[model samples]
Target: MPVKIRAATQHMAMFSVDADAAQAMIDYSGLRVCRYRPNRAVAVLMLMRYIDGDLGEYLEYGTNIMVNPPGSNESGMRALQSAGAFIHHLPVDQAFTLEAGRSIWGYPKVMADFTVTDGHHFGFDVTIDGQFAVGIDFRPGLPVPSRFTSKPQVHPTYSHLDGVTRETAGEMTLSGVRYRLGGATVRLGQHAYAAELASLGFPKRAMISSSADNVEMTFGDAKEIA
Candidate 1:
């Protein structure tokens, strides 16, 4: 019997913010994806990160602003009035996940879970707490100005099985996919995951690329299952 092959494409983005800020910015309005073949599958994913600053900034008044207040405005003046000098260690870490059209199939599935320690320390006081948002906008094909950007007719089925465990601080295995949560350990997984990643021009250490820019990563550790 002759063998049949199928192909899929994906795009993704991951963003992070601090906890002291009153609100976070998410701009997914500018994203693009290209189709490799006429009938190949495609999808996109986006990840967001949020960090907490400190309690002092949180307690201070006039930290939240409706819009970008001018530096010479009253709001800016109030922000400075309550400002104080303090040092705090803030956590900076990445979170990964998938966001794409439900109709598209054969596209790579994405997942990410981890904990971040005090990744950075800032001497100056800065508010970090705030609302954050992650947005996704995916279509088909490269740069083009036309109606109905062609998409593959086929839709791939995804199996979101879960039963993995975090056996160590730097590693977590879920549904046969191993994730290197931290440290220098590298993760590996099935060919489907690897192939999807390669087609999207993802980084070598990525288990999956959650966006077009490959900013978010789900590190693939040694798998316990085939």
Candidate 2:
């Protein structure tokens, strides 16, 4: 584990996408989409604001599809054991993180013009090359309290770059969490990636949404998986 995000905030939403549609997005990434059901798959849209970390301060927006763990092609229903994630598009507002992400773990991090605003609800907007990309608003839900220590929970992450596919163990823990049933809103823009998301059905009410006021994560060693 070389990269560490010591402190940050994470807000994310989950949506169910057509398994086939999800697969199409990551076909070239050498990762397999996890078909949780007969025809259903899952996609996660995550927003992260890093206050302190090895990569320094930065903001990141990611569109990711749930994936089947490497070396297994089981009948997609085994999502519990194969909770890997393959990032389809990742956007950041800083250059150093953009370069480090791509070079370190092969994360598909792209430069973007982005901002976050706080009020009754949270707002995030992004533009790429001066073209509008996406806008998202989140209303913090009820707080979930836990007295247990924040322990590291490892999850699989996949990335493909320069004709190489890598797998990493991303361990993270969250504190001061809150969740809402239907408080997330979004708008897609003219960016090509936005269009791609539209193809898979974006700008809709997510199945669920959650926000973590604090987060700590360590990106473990990356291994060639494909």
Candidate 3:
């Protein structure tokens, strides 16, 4: 199969977690977490609006634990550097993408109701299985050099299955990008899955940012983690 491409606008944030707690999430993912210290790891919360893709328009909510590439000690850099995300939870607004994501990449995606509103800032509300899961409010910050203008990025990600795990690699490009660091408000509700995210310290906002416009991504095939 060929790489699946999507045009999107995304809101992302990074935060510090109790390294032990973050490690627990990584361990649960069946992939090892690279420690910044003896007990510290990083968590990323992403909300995406897919304007065009194989499945057309949809919304995706990803809660991820950023880890090192399998056995590599690349932790000397930043967490997002690896892009080897251990997806803690991924919720989307459509079944087509849900089926495609799972069948193509082994992504643990499910259907949900999503309201992603973007303007002066970006915000989203997501509900899964008829329960409120998460809500986030983000403010745009400043412009940094565009990565989409530079070389494309190939990110390797890991997902767990029955007694085994898989690896999915993706390449991404973006344009007309303006980066900013600002404030975020995250609400973790009473849903069971929502609680699972809370366990990873979702409420604490360490870093928040937004892209003003022009972003695209191509997600490639998923392979076995060897």
Candidate 4:
């Protein structure tokens, strides 16, 4: 049996960090300094172009980050505390608009525009819009590293036309099976698949379940899910 994919979408946004202002905020708050780009290994510009959606949603990356209170010693536990505060202050009123299109590689593409009030401000408002496409592929599955815990997974195996893109590719993993972008192979785990989706900005509260013959993903709101 093959796994079935229901819906896929994209989001994009543009943002700027006032490094000087952020530094001042850190100083005033007595918090440890943090960089706008927390994940130094990944290319911010490349991700911006690839993600291709609202600016507010994709602009900020990484987990909880915060400025330590002024005069407080920079200790690991204190830093974690500040991080928790940062999470508590996240902005929730962001909006996005998406326009559908196709990528150069014939993958589905969505054009998006995004904006944030102030990156330096805790819980700044943001807006975004973007497009995404999902389809079937015939790529081979890759092996999962042994250090991880969980059974291996595989890609959905089926052939049908849903008026989606005929040609599309991106990495996908399910049930411990890893699937290559544009390829139809899967070799990873279910948990890994769910984690990847969440990391990519999928709604965390959404339900992901599987039957013997199919995989199911359900979101609360249609607008948010698409």
- Model 1 bad stretches (over 4 Å): 1-37, 50-159, 162-196, 199-226
Clashes of 2: 0
Candidate no. 3 TM-score: 0.89
What digit string (tens of lDDT, one per residue) describes model 1 on residues 1-226?
Answer: 1111122122322111121221211011111111122221122222223122111111110111121111222223233232221101111222121222111211122332222222221011112232121112222223332222232222111111232211100111111111121112112233343333333333222222221111111212212111
Best by lDDT: 2
TM match of model 1 to true structure? 0.17
How many steric clashes between backbone atoms does each model show? 22, 0, 3, 48
Across 95-138, the per-residue lDDT of candidate 2 in tens digits comes to 99999889888999999988789777898988898888888889
Model 2 residue 111 distance off true place after TM-score fit, in angstroms: 0.6
Candidate 4 structure lDDT: 0.24
Cα-lDDT of candidate 2: 0.84
Q: Give Cα-based local distance difference scores for all models.
A: 0.20, 0.84, 0.73, 0.24
Q: Model 2 Cα displacement at 123 (Å)?
A: 1.4
Q: Write the per-residue lDDT of candidate 4 for residues 1-226, one digit (tens) a residue.
A: 1212332221111122333433443232233433324421110110111122212233221112233333443534334333212211111222231211121222122332223222222111122222221111122334444344133332211111222212122222223323232222112223332233233333311111111111122212111001
54: Cα error in model 2, Å: 0.8
Q: Estimate each model's TM-score.
A: 0.17, 0.94, 0.89, 0.19
Which of candidates 2 and 3 is the stronger one according to lDDT? 2
* 10 residues in a row with least lDDT, candidate 1: 55-64
Error of 4 at 78 (Å): 9.1
